[model samples]
Target: METVKEFAGMAAGTLFFILLTWALTSSYLEEYDLTSAKPATASVAAKVGTKSLLRPPAFFVKIRQDDGSPSEELHRISRSQMEKLSIGDPVSGYATGPTGFSTIRTIVYDSIFYMIGIFIFGFISLCCLFATILSIPAIDQAEQRSSHKRAVKKKRERRKKKKKPKRTRSGWGLALGCVAFFLLVTLPFLSNLVHSALPAGKNSAEALIINEDSYVTYRKHEDSSYRFNIVFDDEDGETILAIKDVTPNTYRNYSIGDSLPIEYQTSNPYNIHVRGTTLTDIQQMLLTWEMFLYAALFAVSGFVIWAYVNSRKNGRRDSRKGDRFASR
Candidate 1:
């Protein structure tokens, strides 16, 4: 049983620490929401609004005309366009046939989801914090019971005309000090909680290239997975390309610079088109931080349980040894 005075003091002190920590963390959360993986604020510089380069299904060459000839005009002639368009063909309007999601919608939806997640995580933090705080009283109670038992032993020793005992548990000062120490240990862990998301876009000035290099890559390298940079526009700008084997012997490739097939965003640009396939999944920094934090939490919890069990065992062992020596 805890003295009312001690219990009230401890309870008040613990709540104070929790509120202080929550305030500091909330401020930092706001900052994180502003800067990192923000869909609304983050955007690619260029956009692939209405135009996409059509790669030829077959080799297509231009018809040559010398003077005022309709056939001799300079035009981008892909194999698909050749059946309908002749030389000097002036194609009008956006390429509509590509099927995919819109960047603007994805960005908006992602931002909303992010806001929801932050709110939910804040609640979870409170729950974990409550668990930590509640553990304090149980820790205090265990110490107190051990102290009371030691007192009984001392009284019995005095009856036997033995020397007075020095001390066992430190005192109430130690108990109060432990509340502070718990704060010192667990407060910093709040930093590990995190959330992040990325958006890629086409006008995003990224590179997509397929040539002899890719052909040689598949032929030379065996089936070990790899992450490497590939040249986008003119080999000067390099964006990350993910190469994965979706099928048994076929490689799926992705350039990080482009958005999904269709759609536009007013605020964000870096939104990339994502498919059901895991071909383009890339790890973000926030996720790694969260992983480390959770790992640390587990480690500390294990240590706490270990310390409690070890302390009880040692207390019992010392009591038995003291009794043996007194008998002698």
Candidate 2:
């Protein structure tokens, strides 16, 4: 009972460390939180010809669409400013109203995370090192009992060989399993990136919302999780959609009967994204967060497997050492 308790304690400790470390470094940003779609003003800055001679000369030029019409409002040009501004030009973007987020990469949040990661990583590494150190004496005892260990290992191999008759995966089964696992793990993010990399039909297809669901505000809880269904008349009959995620706009509101654009692939009519939309910084952050979480889960599962294997090895060694000392 004491030995069982000790074993459980060790397991709990290892799990605690692994989970705590992962939580610190994991990114959980939501893509819907990062979208901005308000009409913004764009004005090109007058190009300041090559500011510094030493540095790779950079220039900024202002751009503004001038309509001689009396009702035009002047706006600053930015990447998210929803204006036509050329790259490497003096284009600054500001939210016309109070809708744009930090627009600064959420550096403050990153700094807090940086500190948290450092603290957790340092703590867990230290704990692992301590465990390794404590095992040195046990390792010495194990070295003295190598022969009994060989006998036990042989018996384990016999058992495993016999047990293999119960479960078997053929070559094709293994290959298919691996393929399914990979697709399940990676397709969503790849598809999201594909929305940009793969060209949509140059000729826009007809799209209308069959079920917009309910209105969701994108800005609160700092998460932008919006779900809706869009149905469109496709080559394959009238196709209906339950859009898993549509990145939210600045308003953070998508209600019934609101028209959101969608672009579909010409070759594969099903591929689509909201029209006039690129992955916003927030959406990118959310995607990155997802990858981070998956990676953390993978790492933790790998570590647990490794630790299980190591513990089994250690137990065998300990049992051998006990038997050898008892013999002496």
Q: After superposition, which runs of candidate 2 have C-alpha atoms over 4 Å from their true positions?
A: 1-184, 200-203, 213-224, 235-237, 250-254, 278-288, 291-328
Provide TM-scores for the models: 0.21, 0.31
Tell me model 2's lDDT, rounded to 2 decimals. 0.47
Q: For candidate 2, lDDT tens digit of each residue in 1-328?
A: 6545655565567667777666555532232232443434444423221111011112223343344222122232222332233433334343323534232222233356555675877687568656644445555457556558788789988899765634433443554455456556655555556554566343355455445433444553343345454556555564433243555451244555656565555543435545555457356544544556556655655665566567668878999999999999
In candidate 2, position 86 carries an lDDT of 41
Candidate 2 at residue 264, lDDT?
56
Error of 1 at 19 (Å): 13
Residue 46 of model 2, lDDT score = 32
